[model samples]
Target chain A: MEKQVILDPQQFDLTVTRLCHELLEQHADFSNSVLIGLQPRGIHLVSRMLDKLQEILPTPPICGNLDITFHRDDFRRREIPLIPSVTNIDFSIENKKVILVDDVLYTGRTIRSGLDALLTFGRPIQVQLLVLIDRRFKRDLPIQADYIGKSVDTLNHERVKVSWKNIDGEDRVELYIKQTHE
Target chain B: MSSLSVDHLLGIRNLSVDDIERIFQTAQSFKEVINRPIKKVPSLRDITLANVFFENSTRTRLSFELAAKRLSADVINFTASNSSVKKGETLIDTVNNIIAMKVDMVVLRHASPGAASFLSKHTKAKIINAGDGTHEHPTQALLDAFSLREKLGELNGKRIAIIGDILHSRVALSNIYCLQKLGAEVLVCGPSSLIPKGIDSLGVKVSHDLTETLLWCDAANFLRIQLERQDSPFFPSLRDYALQFGLTSEIMESLNKSIIVMHPGPINRGVEISSSVADSSDSIILDQVENGVAIRMAVIYLLAAQIER
Candidate 1:
């Protein structure tokens, strides 16, 4: 029943600037690297990062969006009519260093699905995961993010919500207790 | 409608309009999956599907088998041509034996009607009726309707004339139910004898004139004359039938406006529809075949997902 703000708009902007500098330090040219945003939610983060990466570098890299809806492990656990989002990766991801961007890292199942979904485009030379809010030690799969904005330890019942300025009129991260039927 | 209550896709009638939409919505996902470079997913890796076909088929069996494989399920193909069914085993025993092997689902095509509906009562595995005797080809109807919606958006109030052997078509029967459910005006056009009695009672208009019907429709789905399934003469001859009802270029061109052409193939090219019209731009006949895999995948994925609940 309680909610707490973790990162406000100013802190989030500074975090993005640091991440951009770290990314520029490693992959200076941004030629062989490509960024992919996991669909339905990661799209917002991908757009922000792509914009930020362009500002931080001379050349912005190729970016695409992927939907891992069909690749999910729990399709059978849910009801019928699981609506699929659009996957709009026009160019090939072949042999590129792929960076998967997402809003949160929870069970790592979404990242697993995203990895599987990425294989469809072509086998990438290397794949890395990036999350704005990494919920540490909460993985059902053995996936760990290579680049994390902030690592926060939390209870299984708590939810991490990432909001964007374009979407929720503010850039912020919050923690809340996920409500379930009693 | 929330989830498919029936456990098996025995017929389109078993699904509500909402269920059909859900299936299409799910199919949209699989359609995207196949377009990917790997074209496979591990969602059904733990699930095994036994395609127990009791009749000769090419497209339907291949499509379902591909669908299962694409979903990363183990596929065990049991055709009547090479099965114990040829050695005097009953349908129930053969399928139950497969299910006993821990097969999670069965995609069936039987010569007898209600084979899937019958088998679902005995087996713990989920069932998907690929096709049954003049009964229903649920996936075909689903793909056909899906292809239609994909080609021309919003099926509500769209006119679709299903032209050809209605009396012998499981496709026609299923399409009528499916199309009508989506709020499309359906017209069944064929030879008088080929038209089943009291078909209009299903709330579809009946027409013997193909041109008249084609002109009235935004989409015309041509059913191949089911020569293989015919026991006795329903019409006088193929030539006479083609003369009266064949969809030629002239007939098609006369309509002035483009109508979406569809066929549940193995098309009798010059009989029901001319070769020209079959290969026409507006024809989504091949798209239906490609969409068949995605539709079957959606059907299996949804059915297998709901076995426990």
Candidate 2:
């Protein structure tokens, strides 16, 4: 496998700051607007964004973690079972403008499942998607992210990996390309 | 491991400590799912389940049905009294008939010891032994252990006493296997007649004294005296049995340290345990019932994920 650094630590912080600025411009003060982080990986990015946003804004919006394992389309279609994570939304999302956050936007199935999971809490006035990295042309569903930090084009055999400073001890995005053996 | 080692949950003996831990972990997630506003998930939406009870059941049947429905699975219920088993239909034929209708799983409760094992060999659907005579009630034991672990942090080095009928109650046997496998010490306390032969060979201490056994353990699981399974008198009388073995409030007051009380109900109120003690804060009988749904959901979800698409 061939590894290539897509975003270094300095660029990663700048991208998060730019994304939070875009969110502040649109949702202005974030009143009646909430952010929901997809579980396992998305929560890391969401918490980082929340920390950056709170530095400038007076009030932070209600943020929660949502797990979509039970709402996935591929329930029995896989070889192994999908383990669920903790969904810790304590407040209501009724008639709120909800932004669904994730680390990477891949096949768009996770967002689709997230949409279904979000409805179980309550109906939202509007729902939008946010991602740190968007893999262009790899979507299997008719879904798109409203906010994107960076968009990269790649082949299906290549992968995108995101690391956090708190978790992986560094903030970096790397692309892993499978080497051909022919 | 993501999946269970055995496809069918026939008994606790077939499950390893890893399998039990996985079940408890999955159940912790489902417990949150059920407490939500919707109280349902779509994991098993395309699958169909059949509750095939050859014997009578009220709680177990309702628990299984609710668990299946909560996962968004279609369910069909069958009871022996109303089914073709009365017309001489064999167990395989009944199960095969259900499987012919595209049922993916069978939750079975029969009076025979190995009826679940028998159906698993003859039928094509996955089998979950709801209760197989005096053999095993694996799900009940799972929920009981799950509830106990919730009240108590872990089962390692914890002392648990199984009180009351051991010969006729399948719950006791399943609990013994489950609690012991989780590293808890077990002691079966009852009259010599009700205690089965060679129970000590299962590696659990046997005692006839209730107070001494309760004093020795951290938790006491009092079982219901099954009069339906008793062919002849195992003890002198219900009054005599209550006087000797029943968990009364006086016994609760006598114990220096408070012990957790548990009962797998349709509790024989005032027979094996008094009503006050069963309803006490230390008693987790109702939590066991609530955990039953989540445990069954985890079991079915894990097994259904392994089914060939």
Candidate 3:
């Protein structure tokens, strides 16, 4: 396998700030909007975004973590069982503008499951997606992020790894290309 | 990513400690699902399940149905009393006919022992034993243990007394296997006749006194006397049995420490446990019933993933 670092701590910090500036431009004061972090990985990005947004905005937007394990289309199709994470939405999303945040946009299947899971809470007036990294040309579904930090082109055999300081004790993004034998 | 070690949940004896812990972990997630505003998931949208009960059941049947529905699976119920089983149809014939309808799984409860094991060998669909004669009610034991673990943390070394009708109670046997596997100390307390022969060989302590057993344990699971399974009188009379083994609130209040109480339902009200005790705050009988859905959902969800489809 080959590994290449695409973003170090300094570049990652600037990308997050850029995403937060774009979010402020879209949802002005954020009175009628809610922020949702997709569980397992997306939560990290959303947490960092919340801390950054809290500094600029007078009031931080309503936030919750959504787990889409049950709504996934690959229930019995996977080799290993899918374990679910916690879904903690304590506020109502009725007629509110909802922004779904995640660290990476891959095959769009996770976002598809996230959409289905979000509807269970309540009906949202409109929904948008935000991601730190968008892997171009890799989506199985037509899902594009409203707010994007960076876009990278890759093959199916390659993977994108995002590490946070609180979790992996670093702030960096890397691409891993799996070696194959023909 | 974790899957069950076994394809079918035949009994607690067939399960490992890891399998039990996995089910509990999954059930913890499902418990959250059921509490949500929309208590349904699309995990098992394509799977079909048939609840085939050859005997009468109230909670187990409904619990299985609710669990399947919450997972968004297609379900069909079959009761032997109203079905072709009353007209001399064999067990294999009835189940085979159900399987012919493209059923992916069968939750079976029959009067004969090892019925689920028998059906699994012959049928193409996965089998989950709801209850089979006096053998084992694996899900009941699971939910019971899950509820206990929720109230009290980690059952390791905790003394649990299984009181009343050990011989005819499938719950008792399965509980013994499950609790022991989780490192809990188990004591079977009942009349000598109902306590079964050579039960100590299973590594559980046997006692015949109710008060003594209560004083010696952390939790007491009071089982209803299986009057339907009793061929002859095990004791003198219902009054005499109540005087000896009935769990009343008075008995609970007399204890130095408050112990958790449980009952796998269709409680024999005034006989095995009084109404006051069953309704008291100390009892987790209702939580046991509620956890029943989550535990069954976890079992079916895990087993369904193992299906070739």
Candidate 4:
């Protein structure tokens, strides 16, 4: 097994700043748009994005936290049980632009579940995906992110993990490679 | 699903504390699933369930049916009146016929005690006991605990007084089994004759005095007194029973502490609980009914996880 550090603490901060700026470029006033962070892992990423968005705009629109555990495709196929997080979308998503935020985009199955779960609140005029890490050439679905912080090419046996400062004690991106033959 | 001890949910007696926690945790997820706009999930897709009710019921049967349907499982319902049970067919024979049709699970409500467990041994399909005759209603107790946890946060060290006819109550037996497992102190309060013999041996306090029990408890579950089940008089008369045990607003105010009020269903109104006390904010009878679906769904999902085919 091997490990690769794609982004250090300084690089991760820059990526967060750039992604927040990219978000503000499309949604300037945020009048008809709202931010939603996918549940469990995405909640931390969304709060970080919100902290960055607050620097640009004094008052940001309400943010939603969505749980896609029940809507996932491999619910029965998986060996481990799925525990669902809370879906805290107080405001309606009707006819509003929604940006779904997550930490990583790999097989795109999570994003697909998020998309299915998002419609349960209300029909959105437009929907976009924002991820901190984009694992290239390994999508089980045809979905693509509208906003991405960094894209990395990895093998099928490789795993991309985004660590947060609060949870994991530091901010960084690392890839774990399995050494089956070596 | 990782540590689920039993393949079938026959009673709370066989369930470990971890199994109860797992069921409650899974029910919490299913509760969230029902709040969605689509109101349906495909988790139980390709699974089939049959609801076999050999006894009369309203809430438990419908709750199990709705829970199965919400999980996207194909459901077929059978009642004693409409089925061959009326023609003297045995329980195993009737259930085996349904299992032969490739049904995955069975939610059964029978007047005979241990009917689900008996069927579980004879048939390959998983069995869930909605309610057995004076035995244990596992799902009912789970939902009651779920509702109590919602109101009181957790069951640990909480005092719960289950008041009414314990002799005939499947609910009391099951609730005692579950609440004790969840670390709640249980008190069985009822008329001396109405309280079952040896109920005190199950690690719960038994008392006929209502005020003393109410003062010592945080929640009170007033079980319906089945007049039909009492062939010989347990109490002197209805008026005597009501005067002694009926929960009134005056009794509620005398407690001087906030307490949760719960009842199974089909309330006798002025008999067991007065209208004022039953309609008060403390009464979570409706929440108990709603959580029934989620609890049943959790039981089915966890049990089905162990099914090989």
Best by DockQ: 3
What digit string (tens of lDDT, one per residue) describes model 3 on residues A28-109? 9899999999998999999999999999999888899999999998776665347888998999899999999999999999
lDDT (C-alpha) at residue B68 in model 1:
92
User: Of the true contacts between chains A and B, what fraction does model 4 have?
Assistant: 0.45
lDDT for each residue of candidate 2 in B64-100, tens digit (9 for 90 to 100): 9999999999999999998789999999999999999
The candidate with the higher TM-score, 1 or 2, is 2
Which residues of candidate 3, in runs, are more than 4 Å off?
Answer: A179-182
- Candidates' C-alpha lDDT: 0.86, 0.93, 0.93, 0.89
| Local error of candidate 4 at residue A15 (angstroms) | 1.1
Candidate 2's error at A19, in angstroms? 1.5
The residue pairs found clashing in candidate 1 are A120-B37, A120-B38
Ordered list by DockQ, greatest first: 3, 2, 1, 4
| Structure candidate 4, residue pairs in collision | none
lDDT of 3 by residue, B104-198 (tens): 99999999989999988988899999999999999999999999999889999999999999999899999999999999999999999998899
Best by TM-score: 2
User: In model 4, which runs have C-alpha deviations exceeding 4 angstroms?
Assistant: B1-3
Given the true complex, what DockQ would model 1 score? 0.52
True-structure lDDT of candidate 2? 0.93
Candidate 2: DockQ? 0.65
